[model samples]
Target: MTGALKVGIGGWTYEPWRDNFYPAKWPHKRELEYASRHVTAIEINGTYYSTFKPASWAGWRETVPDDFVFAVKASRYCTNRKVLAEAGESVARFVGQGLVELGPKLGPILWQFMATKRFEPDDMRAFLALLPAGEAGVKLRHAVQVRHDSFACGEFVEMARAAGVAVVYADSADYPAIADVTGPFVYARLELAEEANPHGYTDAALDRWAEAARLWAAGGRPEGLPYVEAAPPPNQPRDTFMFFINGAKLRAPAGAQALLARLNAPA
Candidate 1:
């Protein structure tokens, strides 16, 4: 738990958030400005559907605070390819599109595969190899979100670790949850938000997650979470990222804010 704990929602442009999360009468254009001030990180989902101009990326960077980080979902053109190895050009284009404009605010690039996509170790290895260690001198981080149940195996974890790629810890009933920590950092997408609890998750759930983040930051695997391996190897501390997404989306911001409060982390 020596590093930072970043708790945030998937995206800030939801229509429901305007009434529930944003300040009353807040300008729509200023939503990013406001959300950035309240959360440490944001998962940019728009990029997953389409590409943006370089100016758009630069403008987004200017809108957020200096310490705020944005984790971008890789474009479908890249992740949706049949052969991952053939996606090198698409990967380069996606990265070069305007990610550099995001600069230091850029966080990990999430590569979410189709639900039908099964685990192919060789393809996965090639895909991971395409992920650049750094772009224009700034270190790059990549997280793979494999939805198929076949990915719930020790071999997949080993392959991810070999490629230095992180296997996203997806907390969702629809997908197989793999809590293994393959990289130095932990990426979690919590989809258990409850409408009954306006803060997204109840106090007890938040407490458990806070404790888990501490454990991960301390280089230890948190007990109770689903894992392919028995335990993670002892290592140095890591930065932990937890995002509240799906399952009562309107309550996501509240859940993120509540978790941040527990971690004693700045928004």
Candidate 2:
């Protein structure tokens, strides 16, 4: 059996979306409600820079649909540092800061590193060790987005796989793209949207991404992507989360919705 595939944008709150995506004069507070209905999932970017109250997390959970999920970006303190191995306290604080309030709505927690951060095997392993398997009864899935080219190595993939932590597949011109499926689930960040196109990406591009998402959900790797390791893993269905992020930020929602439409279409 194939796993579930979710397509979404980085976040719901965007001024451009208010004019193009949301209804005219829609309540600002209900943007999440509207966006959640359109997309299958969302990657919460705010949590990476700031902390929210437990009530805020609970309120967000109430706003989204039952099947909708949110992938939260872990705090900068937990990722941006000179020494990753020393981030235990920060990691614990970020993980325990009421993420459990989201309950089942919580998906993966993205740990994004700075562009300058290079791969250090021992340090990375230590940081991975600090990531708890669960938080307050909710099983947590972690995905790391490493920006530097140094991360594009088999050793890094091996370490992540050993820890059951997915190495984020970043489709960006500036970042190193690693398509290695190192964990039980797949996390992808697509950042090639264009402002000129109404849907950010071309129809052909969207079709290709949709097909790739399907292949990933079915435990099969897609062609034309870079991989650190040449060998394939055992075939096992895995949940897939793909988000339209970064480039042409204003068109992210459209791209996400269009991709979701393809995924939900008759197969």
Candidate 3:
């Protein structure tokens, strides 16, 4: 089976995007409506910093297209602590906070770690165990974004795979890029956007990413990406989620749209 590929930007609201992506005179409230139509998915970065009411989540769900998905960023309180096992309360609060209101529109929850946090195998295992398999009636998917180079080891990949959690393949100059497929799905964050290019990336770069997305959807790892494990993941199709984030934030939407166009084009 060939799983679906979704390409999108981090958050929808940005003053710069209003000028380039949004229509002239478009109401600020309807920005999500416009963005959801243009991209297949979006990573909710705001959720990482603050909690919202159930009505807010529901409203967000209602504004997007039927097939659009929102990948939520887990709150910093849940992952920034010294003891991963002791974060049960924070994790519980985050999971119980109106995420189910999005229902089927919700995708993976990104558990991002700070750059200073080193990899502790035992602590990491305990943390992964803290993530519940399901919340309310909706099945939950999780992806972890580890920034420290200490996480760039086969042991980390193996542990994530055992827990059925995807290790985020962050394409950043500062962070260690771990492209191992450790879960049933693939999650990637592209962060090398440049203001010099209107689309955030050159046409060649976009094409390369488009192909990479296709390969990942087909359960194949693309070449040239850094990986800790020498062995490939199981040759089984899996859903692929990609987001254009950070760096040249102004060009993110255009980057997402351009990549989506490439994915939608004929083979």
Query: Candidate 1: misplaced stretches above 4 Å?
Result: 265-267
lDDT (10s digit) by residue, model 1, range 244-263: 99998989988888888988
Please give the ranking of all candidate structures by lDDT, highest first, separated by commas.
3, 2, 1
Q: How many backbone clashes does candidate 2 have?
A: 0
Cα lDDT tens digits, model 3, 66-126, are 8999999999999998888899999999999999899999999999999999999999999
Measured with C-alpha atoms, the lDDT of residue 169 in candidate 1 is 94
What's the lDDT of the predicted structure labeled candidate 2?
0.93
On residues 126-176, what C-alpha lDDT tens digit does candidate 2 reach at each position?
A: 999999999888999999999999999999999999999999999899999
> RMSD, model 1, all Cα superposed?
1.8
For candidate 3, give the lDDT: 0.95
CA lDDT of each prediction against the hidden true structure: 0.88, 0.93, 0.95
Each candidate: RMSD? 1.8, 0.7, 0.7
**Candidate 3 ranges beyond 4 A from true positions:** none
- How do all models score by TM-score? 0.96, 0.99, 0.99
Clash pairs for candidate 3: none
